[model samples]
Target chain A: MPSLPPIRPEDVAVAEKTRPHGAFDPPSDAHDPVRAGYLMRLGDDALILGQRLSEWCGHAPSVEVDLSLANVALDLIGQATLLLNEAGDADTLAFKRDVLDFRNCWLVEQPNGDFARTMVRQLLFSTWQHMLYQRLTASRDEALAGIAAKAVKEVAYHRELAAEWVIRLGDGTEESTKRTLDGLAWCWRFVPELFEVDAEVEAAVSAGIAVDPRDFEAEYRAEITRALGEAGLPVPDDQRPILGGRRGHHSEHLGHLLAIMQYLPRTYPDAKW
Target chain B: MSDWPLWEVFVRSKGGLAHRHFGSVHAPDAEIALRHARDTYTRRMEGVSLWVVRSSDIVASDPDDAGQLFEPAADKVYRHPTFYEIPDEVKHI
Candidate 1:
């Protein structure tokens, strides 16, 4: 056999061209604050929920569930990194931002009350995210489209895993069913806010940078209804619409969450790994 | 739950490879067992395919009979391929 040539930095660079992570070249043009805000909103949703799920790292009911929850959390955090990077410096965006500046919807920031509650919130969010990402894969913004394409597969698994737990618990023992119903009821009110399209959302939709969630409102409702039906549960009555997360108005929960998440970074602002 | 059944997992690392036993997981049922196996063993792209079966379903030989079953074969060197002769041109053998 012929002797192999010494590897060079240039050859390593060429070999890395086919690597998936960090392969997508983000657009270099400056984006107005509005467009940047849109990307941050998407990123915040993943980041906040990822943080919530990570709280279960050492505390989930079983080893199997613990791994599964952490798996999904890592996937969400990975998506958040890509999205926040597109908006600006991902570290600054995630570690330095104040609660009022966060754009994640209220659902993700809700406490992980129990396994049932966690799965309920996950099911509600991942279903909506999966549907939205399916459409976003066709976004006019190439960066968003690429992010969506990769994220859609992860979100699909999240949705399936959540649905599995929701159905199993909802239809299992009486206590499990009661807990599942309580989770559904508590999470139901926030469902409407997910599809609420405000002025900024409208601008993004009009520019083809985002899909109009209103277009799928009926389908979303039907999907929830079907899932609930399988669980032998009823849809909760429509409560007063709890809105304003998009504009940075949030419930008290987000502040507490931010306190813990930002503590290390806030205290030692210049620290690096 | 403690009552949950244990499942043995086998994984095929890639195409054209037979599945080798990887590990096990506990789950309430077959469907969840498959998922638990995937989460537990295949999270790092360790396998392209997974198979999960209830551990109780597997039929394993008794370890106490190991001498009678396997040791006799180890000493039977004449039954082995060590005595085979081949041409210098032979490669795979």
Candidate 2:
């Protein structure tokens, strides 16, 4: 692996102020409507997964793993906040939307199972995000580009952490190895959803505001292949694209997730922390 | 399972300065150790650089040697830069 460059204080200070361009603007037709939806979907994916990961807060295998998972969750939440805050006020988008209106894929809404399953989800999602964000950093849309630039750094670390755990679990004991393989098998079908392109994405690509999901397939495949290889796992031969999130049709899991997540605020609508 | 080891943390605030000891946290290894240090110590943007060292690796002077080690140096007037006077002509001294 390449050495990480030294982080300069000036760079950190600069990044603190780096936010989406649309943060100050309400959704406007002049600003590429398709791109706006695409950005929202990206934000929704991060937000949903972050919420899912937060479930493991007090339940990880160890303190080290707990903190590590929490850190990744925080990063995803931060990205979600930036993207959603730009799309509209974050609170409204996160709390006010109907379940059918959400744009996150079904895979992200699935309940985090055991440690192996969570790691499987993390590995699958972060690998896709790593490729997606890398391309997004250079997007023509300045705000999305800025968000992607900062996010790539966070997601890169997430990928590394997930990849490390996959190796450890896959190669460790017989029981762990079996569980890791089962976890991968359980999640493999959802992998195609990450690459499912939609009309909104097509328009965004035409407008040069977003990269086509199809563009990332090769890179995403290579990353997963290498990681699985190192883990002594085989790639399952079955490949089928599962589509819905981009169309605003999510799994049943999302409703349950939202109910729990929004309960505190919904029950006590005027409560303040 | 083996207990996670504690690590001492140091953080560099910005350019042109050395890292100072920040605090410590428990982690399984150095990579996760640094990540833990970042999440715990620098979440509020207190640092630009992080360094994590195993707590066990740090060597310390014995409490009995404190008088001979540090107290003797306190009385050395020649070692104090305050004894030297800088002329007004010097700009950054």
Candidate 3:
């Protein structure tokens, strides 16, 4: 039999700190198990989208754009780590979970169609994240408040970067502008998901663990409108509620995404990387 | 055609310090250049202030003139205080 290596002091300290705080003892009045689950869903949304964006690491239209996308992806991943680690632990939530256990929104799992589509997705998502994080910074839950305060600054930069790209692509040339409009048209329906205030959200907000998603709708719309206007693109009046991901009914894209994301982990079960 | 021009970036890390040359970025105009500098160079809050000047507009000393312009000062030991003594109470020199 092979003997295991001795554990280091740092590893022991980290392990002691991250030991699970008993399964069901909520952290605070605001810390609902259901809402923690919901926060995980939001975190997963950012994680999946960040992973998708990272695929363009070496294939972007320009080096500046490549670096920008990579930076944005890093910011999203940072946000995901905080939220996921809070929900459970970073390692367990990220690596130990099965595909069926993930609760990310469907739109985030969509394929990166083109630069235009990616920009549109980013614009929509960053707009919502900016508003959400801004309000969440004032959350009664200190941990959540801290996370939000940090993330708010990052999401603000993401919003500006995506907004600039949207304008540049939309107003650049006839082909680019047409593509930008088409991308916005395709992505507009999914915008409703950002503001879908489910029961869990309401409960969490009432307890001060989370912000009311509905409260950000007007600001999101205004920011998006300004961005689209500057981009020389018309905001599509898609009022339909194309919702389901929050309830676990996701678009077909999510399954394919999960297959790719979970392949290595599933293949090497319990293996340390 | 890239409408943007390259701009040299200078960052002041904190208060009461001179802006040190950090890097450069490409941007469409001065306003956008400052913004690009902020986004590209100061993402870590490493700077409290920034300055961006068009690279084309900067007047740089000629590399070929290095011998004539700087070599004369290299041997000027009289400009230094090697031959002089400082008082013990002198805090900084």
lDDT of 2 by residue, A103-123 (tens): 998778888988998898899
At residue A255, what lDDT does model 2 achieve? 94
* Model 1 chain A lowest lDDT segment of ten: A22-31
What's the distance in Å from true for residue A228, model 2? 1.8
Native-to-model Cα distance after best TM-score fit, residue A185 in candidate 2, in Å = 1.9
* Two-way DockQ contest, 1 vs 2, winner: 1
Model 3 TM-score (2 dp): 0.82
TM-score of each: 0.90, 0.82, 0.82
User: Against the true structure, what is model 1's DockQ?
Assistant: 0.71
- The ten-residue window of minimal lDDT in model 1 chain B covers B84-93
Model 3: per-residue Cα lDDT over A144-241, one tens digit each: 78988988888888888788878988988999898888888878888888788788778777777887878868878888889999998888988576
Which regions of candidate 3 fall more than 4 Å away from where they truly are? A1-31, A98-100, B1-4, B27-45, B81-93
Comparing to the true complex, what docking class would candidate 3 get? incorrect
Interface RMSD score of each model? 0.7, 2.6, 3.1
lDDT (Cα, tens digit) per residue for candidate 1, span A1-273: 998888899998988986787555553543656567788889999999999999999999899999999999999999999999888878889998898899999999999999999999999999999999999999998989999999999999998888888889999999999999899888888988899998998888878889998888888888878887888878889998899999999999999999999999899988875
Query: What lDDT score is found at residue A128 in candidate 1?
Result: 96
Q: Which candidate do you rate higher for lDDT, 1 or 3? A: 1
Q: Give the TM-score of candidate 2.
A: 0.82
